[model samples]
Target: MTLTKQHVRDVVDIYIRAWTKQDPDLILSIFTEDATYHERVLGEPIATHGGIRDYWQSKVVESQANIECELLSLYVDGETAIVEWEARFDDLVRGIRKRMREVALLEFDGALIRSLREYWASETIG
Candidate 1:
């Protein structure tokens, strides 16, 4: 099936909402059970729903606060969507505030993301 722009936007909206609210479950809800999530270009992809949940719990729920995310751009074709976004948050582990620019490539299986690859750069802003 062809991917629609609004469908991609809806998924992205949930993504931003999940991060802003620090809701791991909400984020997890968007992926398939066997989803693979590559948080960085060189990092190993986290496979399976359990792994994804663990990553989000530690990375977002435990280690970040005051999160905000903005969608900079989005493009969708076929079953894939590419999204660019910026985020600002406090890193509890590092005790610093950070701003990040990221681009993610998402491949969908039905309505859920089956695989996600992300590339990003971040700076300590506070």
Candidate 2:
């Protein structure tokens, strides 16, 4: 497996597309065999259970369902990328979603994501 500029873009696109559709498998496929997912909550990093099944059973899919994210910016350094996201919850039960910013730090092994650390604000309601 080789890393190229196009692979990174495709991975990010797959990420956004999966998030938009709330498709767990598509989301999971972007990850490597031993991928780790972390979310920064209340100034502490919450390590999620491995793989997409755990993610769907845990928080990512649930949190993702209520909102839609737009890519704000992306910066790449070798096999990593820091992506800025802006999301809005379109559903009424979720209330008026505040514009929240999150930075996804992706670590890639080849074209697969080996790890992800997503940092977001807890104060903002989704």
Candidate 3:
């Protein structure tokens, strides 16, 4: 199976939708069974679909954050994709709003994401 530009865009779309909807299933649906997710702030990567689901559940659904992700740029080369995204969301715990720009390096298995590493920095908003 080959990955296309549209497929990469669709994956990004699904990712944004998952965050906006705070749906664990939607988030999990986009990852391969053995997918690994790494975040710059985290000490270790989240391994496997189950771990990804649990992480999203806690950071998104459980936190009751409203997230909106915007795709800034995207480039694809075969099974690898590089994406820049901006996210604006409410931080329920901090009782404030925040904005972040992140770059993700994603590897695909067919149309699903096989591995993802993201780097991001957040800004506080009143």
Question: Alpha-carbon error at 56 in model 1, in Å?
Answer: 0.4
Query: Which 10 consecutive residues of model 3 have the lowest summed lDDT?
Result: 36-45
lDDT of candidates 1 onward, in order: 0.94, 0.68, 0.90
Q: Check candidate 1 and list the clashing pairs.
A: none
lDDT of 2 by residue, 1-126 (tens): 656656777788888787667777777788876677776533433343244556554454665456567887787887888888777654333544555678888888877888788887533463
Residue-level lDDT of model 1, residues 18-121, one tens digit each, is 99998889999999999999997687899998999999999999999999999999998889999999999999999999999999999999899999999999
By TM-score, how accurate is candidate 3? Answer: 0.94
Q: Order the candidate numbers by TM-score, best to worst.
A: 1, 3, 2
TM-score of each: 0.96, 0.74, 0.94
Pick by TM-score: 1 or 2, better one: 1
Q: Sort by lDDT, best first.
A: 1, 3, 2
Model 3: pairs clashing at backbone N, Cα or C within 3 Å: none
Candidate 3's residue-wise lDDT over 19-52, tens digit each? Answer: 9999999989999999999975367889998999
Cα error, residue 106 of model 2, in Å, equals 0.6
Preferred candidate (TM-score higher): 2 or 3: 3
Cα deviation at 46, candidate 3, in Å, is: 0.4
